[model samples]
Target: MRLKNCHNFKDFRKLAESRLPGPIFNYIDGGADDEVTYRNNTSCFDKCDLIPNVLRGVESVDMSVTVMGQKLDLPVYCSPTALQRLFHHKGERAVAAASEKYGTMFGVSSLGTVAMEEIREKHKNPQVFQFYFHKDRGLNRAMLERAKAAGVEVLMLTVDSITGGNRERDLRTGFSIPMQLTLGGMMQFAMKPMWGINYVTHEKFRLPQLESHVDMSGGATSIGRYFTEMLDPTMNWDDVAELAEFWDGEFCLKGIMSGADAKLAADAGCTGVILSNHGGRQLDGSSTAFNQLTEVVEAAGDRLDVMMDGGVQRGTQVLKALSLGAKAVGLGRYYLFPLAAAGQAGVERALGQMRAEIERDMKLMGVTSLDQLTRSNLRFR
Candidate 1:
């Protein structure tokens, strides 16, 4: 179960489960309601199959792709997830560094434990700042200005999470921000003393992205309250359009699933549209981003980059998405579990494995570059 033994997604997940407490592991593993969408995120890839060609020169494979105006050496980038510090003491710092080593983009969430400025200063690779729309206009503007000042390469506004999803696992385990675990949950943490020791030994956990605007000092506020009270649930296309114009750069809309929404993202002047269902963390029965990819690409691909993330566990799955016209793919738990397993080294290993898988799969498919992948290379079941 050590880092060296971790070669794929399942191995990293098992190692992380063994290393982390039950509640913390579930926080990364659980989904909203019945957890159907979460499971479907990966299962949707099975509905389509890849068709390989033989006798095509493919000794050298180039997996590079340009999505959201960012050139990624691998077609997959690390999607943003909250509370990285909670999972690993190194937090966003580790993810940013590992992704930088691979020459790809890494997203920093508004709920990220580390500040975007710190990540921006430390990493030379392309960075994305993923934030939510706040109820207050001034707060939203301030967040945008802060990210812009930090010189973030991409602005990914998560459009789906106006209100938090009904995460039953959190309720059962009492895993809320500021450590509101139930009695059983408390016992689980006690079972994993190593995690507690690591948590206490590291730097204090604070949502650096929102520390100034939101008063989280002295246990005054919690993440649940922040989502319920701070986020603007009524956010519409107009607000997003203004934010896109304000960012005025490589702006993208994450959590996009439908063709209509993708078209709206293009009309709003977004540079890319990421087809995600928040890793099935929100809207339990919502369609998997992969299921909606072709429609969205047809609707808006001509105008903007169409990317997808969810259930992308294998390199062959990444190829399937690309063959269907995804500019790039995003990885959530695929990297998070590795981060939890062994910090920076674990993340680097996961990224390296993915790159190797993509390279091998590309050669097997008789393609030397990503552009060689097309709908013709795929067969839907």
Candidate 2:
């Protein structure tokens, strides 16, 4: 199927599966052990019901929202993931242009294939730098400085991934950086000949974000090693607080789950907290972001901008999050699969479908503006 046929997350996912090698596709699609949290991330929305009101004239809907000092025309923004160029030749470039067109924020992972400076120079919309704390303090500071120099709007430090999760899929498939494949994985690659041809024909994949800081060339750094040996498992609130103060910019923590942690983030001067479970990639069986929204938002909603990511697929889900006081929501596979399937066009189509869904749902809910949504509109069952 092509980009035009892609109507929802699953449609784009199928297209992406057809286009990418099995090992590469699973790297993005699969999650932690048993994939429990991963599955719940999107399915949690099914537990709630949308209470819509009719007969209200929403002639034109205003979906614009401002979060962490950046204005976005839509309530959802792209969540950063690694190894983009491996999925599509355009990679982050495709997502960047689509986010720009939609006037939404787009995050670039610390392990992204594209360079932050290049992405910054190319895209005018808000850009977020998704960072990981390294054991080397100097490297951590240098990364912050580089992102600051690039004029990135938000510095989002991922707190949950001090060490990589137990992703059995990667182990079974033998997926690693620089395209190391097991015998079984090699056969899967051979089966998808078109993906192999496109991958070979396009420019070689490189993690420009970590290329200079880490020796990824010559097979020096594997993703597993990067997590096991390089990341600072000892990272604490104090270190994050100092970084927040140093950046003196729009700072956000991307993996806060509990009310206590959310309060700490607010106390530490974080402008925002993304209630996520790393898209169920980092932690298994952790509570879904949507399920914890009310508690986290109640604890820190006044002091910090509360946003969430996991399991957001439909526009009504986004509206539910907003009605409960989420500043915005994030999209991971929602856009990534589309990017992998048909590059910018696929992403735009996904965003277009989302926009229409949000608009139609908003009017049906009898709201003309985003702020009109309130807790009174929701009732948990």
Instruction: Specify the highest-lDDT model's number.
Output: 1
lDDT of 1 by residue, 17-78 (tens): 99899999999999999999999888888888889999997779999998877888999999
lDDT of 2 by residue, 234-337 (tens): 99989988899998999999999999999999888798999999889888999999999889989995799999998778999999999888999999989989
- Clashing pairs for model 1 are 41-311, 42-311
TM-score of 2: 0.97
Predict model 2's lDDT versus the native: 0.89
Q: Where in model 2 is the C-alpha error above 4 Å?
A: 178-180, 220-224
Model 2, residue 263: C-alpha shift (Å): 0.8
Error of 2 at 256 (Å): 0.3
